[model samples]
Target chain A: MVEIKNLTKRYGGNVALHGISFDIKDHEILGFLGPNGAGKSTTMNIIAGYLPSTSGTVTINGFDITEQAADAKRCIGYLPEIPPVYPDMRVEEYLTFCAGIKGIKRPDVKPQVESAMERLHITDMRRRLIRNLSKGYKQRVGFAQALLGNPKILILDEPTVGLDPAQVSEVRALIKELGKDHAVIFSSHILAEVSAVCERVVIITKGEIRAIDTIEHLERSMTANTLLNLTVEGEKDTALRILKDIRGIKEIKYLNAADGRVSCQLTLEDESVRNEIMSALMANGCNIAEMSMAKLDLEQVFLKLTAQKEKRSSLQDLLDETPDVSGEAPQDAANDTTE
Target chain B: MFALYKKELQAFFYSPFAYVLTALFMLIFSFGFITSIANMDSNTLKFSFPEFFYNNFFYFIFIIPLLTMRSFADERRGGTEVLLYSSPLSVTQIVLAKFLAIVTVFLFMIVLSLFFPIYAACTGKVIWSALICAYAGFFLWGLVCIALGMLLSSLTGNAIIAAIIGEIVMEGLLFLDQVAGSRLVDAYPHLNSVVTWFSMQRRFVYFSQGMFRLEDLVFFLSVTALVLCWNVLSIEKRRYSHA
Candidate 1:
């Protein structure tokens, strides 16, 4: 229902989005995952036709956003990061006005407003001023405003930002329900929220798309290198030596030692290495206290993906222009001599 | 667009803003009305409603910026500009809706001020033609001021700053009228013609004298339209260069 092609946004010399492209199919809830200042809101604003992209085009329901803004906007229901609400207006009055601006028919406005209020469970606060409502309720009211026109696309920019856990879940459920009929683009920095609600995710960082795939696909791909968390009741060096001699163990990172128990994270080449390491440790009088394969969750996958971009960029910079390390080498040698 | 217009009106009337501004408007008009009557010429016992509207405009100009200050600035500050921008309405439509809402409030003030003329008519003689001409001239001048005030509001997203700048600009326009009539401008015929052409007060003088020239009408309307167009452009520019 939405096709964003080569979307680039720049604020003067600073690029907010660098030719990012994505599409939202009908009845799909595409999660837009990014950390703060990752241009998530900038992309959403462009898609919603609030801020014009510096370059590229956004086509909604086959209508170009700039040329056919009215028709294109009619197909969108946007709830900005700040809710875009008038605090002085009553809930119902505000929703009705939203309906009117969205170009709903006069007679249908009342029903649409009421149904939106009902869906958000804000019917009771219909007469209350929006400023008087709590933050959660205000968010719901903003969410309810988006549902008024029953648009084909819904762009929610961190809809659950200020809500409590229960309210967040409620909003997730509502987004899930809305996904049945609309193309929803829900953005949040919370990995769990995205994993819990979205079928497919787009991970963005530093004005670039790091990875775009299903949650299962991303987690499964990241699990190629198995991480085993092992704790042994022995000398830290003895436990490390036993684990190092075993085949299929790639790398070992020491965690901490306490109460005669030494803990470390081991990267294994395969699952078969676990049995060999355990047997070898037992023969060395090292008692196994804790051992488990650490599954890579969405959080870790997100961190690795976002962090990998920075590492690759820095490595490329080193390859392109090797900085002068000769001046720092003498300082390093002097420090080593002192030590 | 009508929905936004209605909401803008509700923003004015729903709060105490419209009532307070309108009350202040009537107070100024009543003060002008009473003073004009008290200062009537003893020899002819004549009271010129046109002259009264002319004298009252200096104070009335201050209120136009107040009426228009919140039109765009409040929306921008409150983050509701996104709603308007993302809506099915175009930039021109949004600007027109807001402009018309403020114009409606201004019209309400003008209509309320008519009570003075009607009351004076009942007690004494009144010239209806001259009075209507003055009302038209005043309303037209107000339209230009309202558009300029809205442009300032949109340019500066703070209501108080918009109002202050609006007062300064309106005072500058009035000052331009004084400068146009001064001996310095009068010394140069070409400069005087250019200055007098842009002077709205000189055109309004023709209007107060009951001369409904299409030149002044077009001038006021075209200036108002120019300002409104500028307001629309300012909004679009902000969206484009949004930081």
Candidate 2:
């Protein structure tokens, strides 16, 4: 298990990671979702012990990362934003060195090296020089390097950033497999990848965490109203009148009535009212064509949350004389959480 | 620490860097050897082989920087430091491993230079005892140079900048000896005394004569350890986000 409490990092006058806190339990694969320069790498660097925090503490298992550094670092395998590899080294030589520096025992080093190469499907490219390999192959070698010693926690930053579609899926599948035992925390801008592999996600933007929840729960939180696209092959006025009789149909926009095929958007007060709207349309003389709920995907939810945060911060900037009013977003999140 | 040391050693030997550096060192040493042989008339039948190494310490001020210019600067510029920094190894271990690797390579070059004394002994009457002492002094001087280069490398992420700074500082120390006796410092006897005390070239004079003073050994070893400790501290400062 990894725990972070009120972690803060400041670079000169600029704040990179504010007083944000979160934790990952054993056997949980948590996805870190954020935009560019959204403090994803900052948080990962702090957790990996590559950088120190200005305040707060990060504890892995029972060992604090700053206090009990060696033991805390012994449990983590970190792959930084850029794969930290020696282009001059061969794949096998590099992995062997990684296992060694990761402090694996002498007798266990060879076996663990082979196991990591096999796990990442780089067994065939073992003897090749890292500089001569393609981008995808280099990435696989980086992943293989991180897998050495089989630490209990894996922190991968943008694991699938540069890869072909097939390689991307292959690495994602490997992450899923590793997550079966290791407590994996991976960050990516790709929403689909997170949805496919992560059980929960921590969404961050502007150095603050916007939300942290399972995909299902986050999807359910924005369910106060839903847009239903209704297409009918009937008279437009009859369909409009039928939709009016349905309760909780708060807003309706008639898209088109060309060729007697009318399209309309019905904003229901709640998702459960969709069946009644369909029943009313059918009870009247209307040939219903299609009805589907306009659900919010992870991408939409991320954009909405981040966009709202940006608007709030920009407003604070206008109000405050100090230009570094961007620091106010965390206070806004704190207020929202308290309420 | 052993793992880091082994990896650093492998990195040097596995690349063409080791071969290239050795060739450069041998090339410069050969120039010094030929000059010494030319200066020694044939009828004399005697030449101090290690004298060429002591005479060419100025060239080493440039050559040693090339050998250690990439120690820490390359790791930072290439972003490979993330691996060592995030690993279980301490900063002291990382710096010491790299320092040891470069020293090992320097020792290899020293071994290769032994051919000069061996060849001279075969051709003429060489002072074997003096040769032994000269070799010891040469190696200690080389260690000091390596430590200075490593410390400069840790001060910046650019290898070229590190090398340039090393060259300047090394050349400054070499020039300090000449300046100590110059007419300009005659007015300030205290400053001249201080500069003369720190001049590495004047200190090498006693070693070149096969004289081993305890103070000299302590000076060389202490300087090496002090510079290396400073190197470790400089690199360790980078582990903090804001420091």
Model 2 error, position A222 (Å): 6.2
Candidate 1 lDDT over A122-164, as tens digits, reads 9999999999999999889888888888999999999999999
- Considering only N, C-alpha and C atoms within 3 Å, which residue pairs clash in candidate 2? none
* Candidate 2 backbone clash number: 0
Worst 10 residues of 1 chain A by lDDT: A330-339
Which one wins on DockQ? 1
- What are the per-model numbers of colliding residue pairs? 0, 0
The regions of model 1 sitting more than 4 angstroms off are A222-225, A228-276, A280-295, A310-339
lDDT of 2 by residue, A13-85 (tens): 8898888899999998999988999999999999999998989999998899989988999999999888888
All candidates' TM-scores?
Answer: 0.87, 0.85
Once fitted onto the true fold, the runs of candidate 2 whose alpha carbons sit more than 4 angstroms away are A222-225, A228-294, A310-339, B41-46, B241-243
Indicate the docking level reached by candidate 1. high
